[model samples]
Target: MPPSVRRSVEQRADSVGFIAVKRAANAIAEAARDSNSVRLSGAEHTAAYLLTRMPATYAASCKVLDELRGVPVASVLDIGAGGGSAALAAHEKFPLAREITLVERDPLLAEAAREWLPAAHILAGDLRRMTTFPPHDLVIAAWSLGDLPAATVARLWEAARVALVVIEPGTLRGAAFVRKVREELLAAGAHMAAPCPAAMPCPMVEPDWCYFAARVELSSMQRRIQGGDLSYQDERFSYVALVRDPVGLPRARILRRPRHHPGLIELDVCTAQGRRSERATKRRDRDAFRAARHAEWGGAV
Candidate 1:
């Protein structure tokens, strides 16, 4: 996480000083074990969530925003904005955005959002009941779609006037949800914007899923609460960017980290045609090999 964001989270955690960090950590662990349980009810658990999960979520959201490099975003609506991490990320990415709205159901989480995101328009309502949403240039649902029904997801996509970005955990199940949502958005006439070369159809199948990882440095308080020896963590996430207007597409997206050898580079790429493994040897293709050498996991080749 960036120093600014880390400081913001730390300040919020400090405000909720009555709760013990250990209890909040334990609550977060218990909630993680059971997906169907209601977790963000009290201030302590909300604070714990800010301390433990907010940084990684913010990092992943920022990664998604980075994909929209040249696109203009003047307004943003973040659905299921727990702790307002997505809103914060959007503000950092597009500082010119005149309006940012955050919709969350839990009262405690909503309260925390008010403290963290004073500039955003916080709408306290259940997503299932939200029949109509306000218009915005960008609509984001980060780590929020898995809990929603397919109909609701489609509705949210329909509300996007410019673009829609959905993010989920990098687990297999999360990838499945992202794939399903991608299909729904495509059916709704949205165009692929990132991490995909085309909008034809997902070429991936079972035992293989599309995902990316973002690295976040853990705060001292976070390390103490989670009892971790490492000073940083990698947050794996699956995301898709859909736009109303057509944009330039990459020829192929590197799905995995490039493999380097003595004089060769291997890249696992997904293109509009299909998934394939391509090799670039220094002797055969000097330029291609140089490009592959610097390519990261999610970059276009």
Candidate 2:
């Protein structure tokens, strides 16, 4: 095989691979929106999410690894793989990588991904409820870490081989969780690359959400899951925060952009002059907090 022909063959293969991944993402997005697979959220404090929520979640996941890190790892473990969007993206970009594992908690999502992404395998397991997980060169947790109990977060951090990147929805709690994780990792002597490159301190504050995107390919099972269509695009920009607090974390910055998704949020936690107070039960409960803070710190300053 001549070098030019070999290169052409490899390029052709890459194009085919790209198409297959895109097909899978489209199916997952469509299936999630499917009424038959309708997953009602039953009013869980936040809006009804998943299945049909943010479609572009695929690109965001790829960004977490490729451009953001600008470095490659031999292995990747995507915990709570969701619809397998990120896993497929990683496989597409790192064609020669050693291994890529997609860990999903929901059986249906795993099943859908199995057919959607033959190149990338799927595992049905819960990060919060798991006893043990195999170590990998890199770990990516997208929008699933905050839902996990605090104790599990600590345990998972300890188990990471190189770096653990945790992404949560762009919310106050999500941004705050990044700080908490950083503190935990730093206390353990893990490196802190960019504490919050997406924002100065943290972008997960009130009403100031930042965004980014990446190109994600589809899986075979995903196409079967959604009836083999490609008109729709599978994109997402949920709140993303990258933390490389592991042994050899790299330097990066918080990314900012505009998109269909809502930005950062502002909540009325209602504190008393930078002092902790009893938890408030009702909206009015914050009034007392405001008064307390104003009395001590001169008007919520």
Candidate 3:
């Protein structure tokens, strides 16, 4: 990530959601301790999905905030504020906010965050156990909700006043997380933030159906790590997010011949959050990125 992006991410690490990112990153790092394979693969996989959906995700989050009657987010809370990038975006977008509290669990990472992040109020503790909670009008959890025990998320949302945003991976696991939160939030009476995955026979039809993207500007470090030399347009990957209401249903703009890939859904960027349609990919190009890495040497991802 660039200094600007890194700076942006670090600036907003005060929220619990953003804090949890370090813990999750630690987990992934641990899982891939042998090599950078796990981290690299995971990052690439996730970026792919988030890049394309950035517009939608960004729009949805803002929409959710709006539905909350435009609450003045004086104090904000980011759970799983990994690297505080998302928090930074929020900070950039909402600067007048008084305080941004990031709650991260990993003490090592939290300490690192202190050195790396000088702007936000970074705190360390298991968010699930938090009591006597501080006042925070906004709460965000992107790609972190799935790692947390389901009950923990329910407990935290009870404190959220203005809005609660949960970004999950665009996979079965991600899909499940999205559903779980949507159900839990509705049960808790939280309002809907984003539209449910509309349409059926999801594009992730067969071999090539599992991917998502986020629009992001990459940093030289990220570019180097990813073995790239240019600015990333749409970071692509496979992702799935759970929302508050109407459960996410797949929405297809133009139906193409569905492909089958065992457990994948064949789909594309059709009606991007109701904006535009996209072309579905052919089977050969589905998992093309998989051959780029190796477990011994980055898993040829």
Worst 10 residues of 2 by lDDT: 41-50
TM-score of each: 0.93, 0.53, 0.54
In model 1, residue pairs whose N, Cα or C atoms come closer than 3 Å (at least 3 residues apart or on different chains), thus clashing, are none
Identify the superior model by lDDT, candidate 2 or candidate 3.
Answer: 2
What TM-score would candidate 3 get against the native? 0.54
Q: Rate the local accuracy (lDDT) of all candidates.
A: 0.85, 0.47, 0.46
Q: Per-residue alpha-carbon lDDT of model 1 for 1-301, expressed as tens digits?
A: 5466567668767777634756876777786654522457576777778888888889999988988888889999999898888988998899899799999888887777787678889898888898888989999999887877898888887788888999998878888989998998888788999889998788888898999888888888877776759999888899999999988999999898889999999999999999999999999999998888898888887
Task: Report the alpha-carbon TM-score of model 1 versus the true structure.
Answer: 0.93
Per-candidate Cα RMSD to the true structure, in Å, reads 2.1, 14.2, 12.1
Candidate 2 lDDT: 0.47
Q: Is candidate 1 or candidate 3 better by TM-score?
A: 1
The superposed Cα distance between candidate 2 and the true structure at residue 226, in angstroms, equals: 18
The superposed Cα distance between candidate 3 and the true structure at residue 104, in angstroms, equals 0.5
Off by over 4 Å in 2: 1-54, 68-70, 119-121, 194-301
